[model samples]
Target: MMSRRQIALAAFISPLLLSTSASFGADIYPSRPIKIIVPIAAGGANDATARALALDLQKKLGVPVIIDNRPGGNFVIGTGAAASAPPDGYTLGWALSAALSLNPLLYDSLPYKPNDVEYIAAISKSYQVIAVPGNAKANTLKEWIAEVKKSDGPAAIGVSSFGGTVHLMAEDLGDRAGFRVEPVVFRGEAPASVDLAAGQLPAMSGILANLLEYHRVGRVKILAISSESRLPLIPDVPTFIELGYPISAVYWNGVFAPKGTPKSIVARLSEAIREIVETPEFRARLAAIPDVNYINGSSDVMKALVKADQDYYGRIITKRKISLKN
Candidate 1:
């Protein structure tokens, strides 16, 4: 409705206004405390990793990074919570690869899609280990396989949850090792380990970090780990690959925000996380844990990792017909 000169002036001011708004958004990104939702119970590996990350991020961002545990429904409950949260970058979820990758194939429906969240960065990758009570007769992988073959009933293997990486690893081990072992699902690792220690279950597979303390106490014996090479934390323990079993799967943990979060905000948070992960203190702490490694990559890299695993697990689940529910 104005003259050409007035219209041009308005156009010039529009870009300036947008630039100012972007700067303000970036500057005030975490004006309030951030909430990091962990889709697992407290005292589990995911919860432990989230708390460790929160501590580092809190120091880096100069704001409290609160951890909210929403454990159940194969990570659907917490993932849904994060997906429905406002996309201001203040509410992020620590997504496990199993939940983001394997759940689609195991369940018929999910509350949120993988694309509903923006991948920030992967914090850590942990290898799975097969362990037994310290007093078990089978002291080695070969011995355990022999015992399972000889057993009349399927060898009971305890797992933290159904449709998780631990569950998939157990299934794959049974398939590749030519043995029959029935997976016994537990609510969490603590209870599973308790039953294993009590000799109720012959063996169990889970993240090495969760079993490290028990292994140190000589209460459990680690047969083999699902890593390409020996873990520095437990150098004596051999990898599944080294034992002639070509099973290698690393459980990764990373940060994600609800989709539609600004690219600028995602970039800022990713950079912050990357910096924290690369620090000497962070590396030293994570390195001390068995079979746990640090992973820092771009958003695109993270997205590709999630997609590839999702596809891989999809094929495995469909082909093997592994179902969590009877």
Candidate 2:
């Protein structure tokens, strides 16, 4: 019963209507809950940061943001899960520089590839610190280096993992200061702190946030930090650079989604995360943990950061002949 002109107009408008509907559909992202996979246990600065972000993100996105902790294998298990997830923007990964940069350099094979995930945004960077037992004789970096140099054999220093940021810094310290360094690997920083507090371990290298409490309570003494300049959290501690050492090792945390995720979703999440990171509330939260302030970098900035860490650490690894292989 329709005229030819009417049929033609209907055909023309139907496609445009469908296209507009699809565009609207694409815009309705995160209608359901989103899960962020954290590659560590449910404690410490990394977990706390992820949980805080999820809380704020839930309020911002109008949907639940859940954290899935998959801690083990130096972040391989969780990172692999995130990398293999569907590119629908529902699953994301909370990662550190170790998983993205150092793992590739240290290992011959990895469960996840660098290209497996797309960088979303950087959250924060934590500087490493060298701490000794609370009752250790050496109270300063100058004295500590002399003490280690005089030790009979390689001094044992606790580390979270071989080739980790702290491990590399410890190795560099030994190489420059004329002492044989032997690393005692632990599952994480907590156990290392335990050993350090009990006087079982001579010294350990860990993030400032984790060691701040121990240092405050007189359980351990932080000799030197790895930041370029001194941090306000512990003003008395001098940086390795200030202590006449060229060691500056800091690790960062960021968010990422599996590759092939829609740019729209990436942009949306990046904007939300970056906004949350810049707020005073969030800044205060991180400051409480005493982490080096929030880093405001989206995808491109994250990419550059990863690459810079890779390049710098790669040189150190190659120069020192560091290897995780047994």
What's the CA error at residue 66 for candidate 2, in Å? 0.5
lDDT at 157, model 2: 94
Identify the runs in model 2 with alpha carbons over 4 angstroms from their true place.
1-22
**Winning candidate number (lDDT):** 2
Which window of 10 residues has the lowest lDDT sum in candidate 2? 284-293
The models' CA-based lDDT, in order, is 0.83, 0.88
lDDT of 2 by residue, 90-194 (tens): 999997889898888888888787777989999988899999999999999999888888879987999998888888888878888888779899989999999
In angstroms, the error of model 1 at 206 is 1.2
- TM-score quality measure for candidate 1: 0.89
RMSD each, Å:
3.4, 2.9
Give the distance in Å from residue 26's predicted Cα in candidate 2 to where it truly belongs. Answer: 1.5
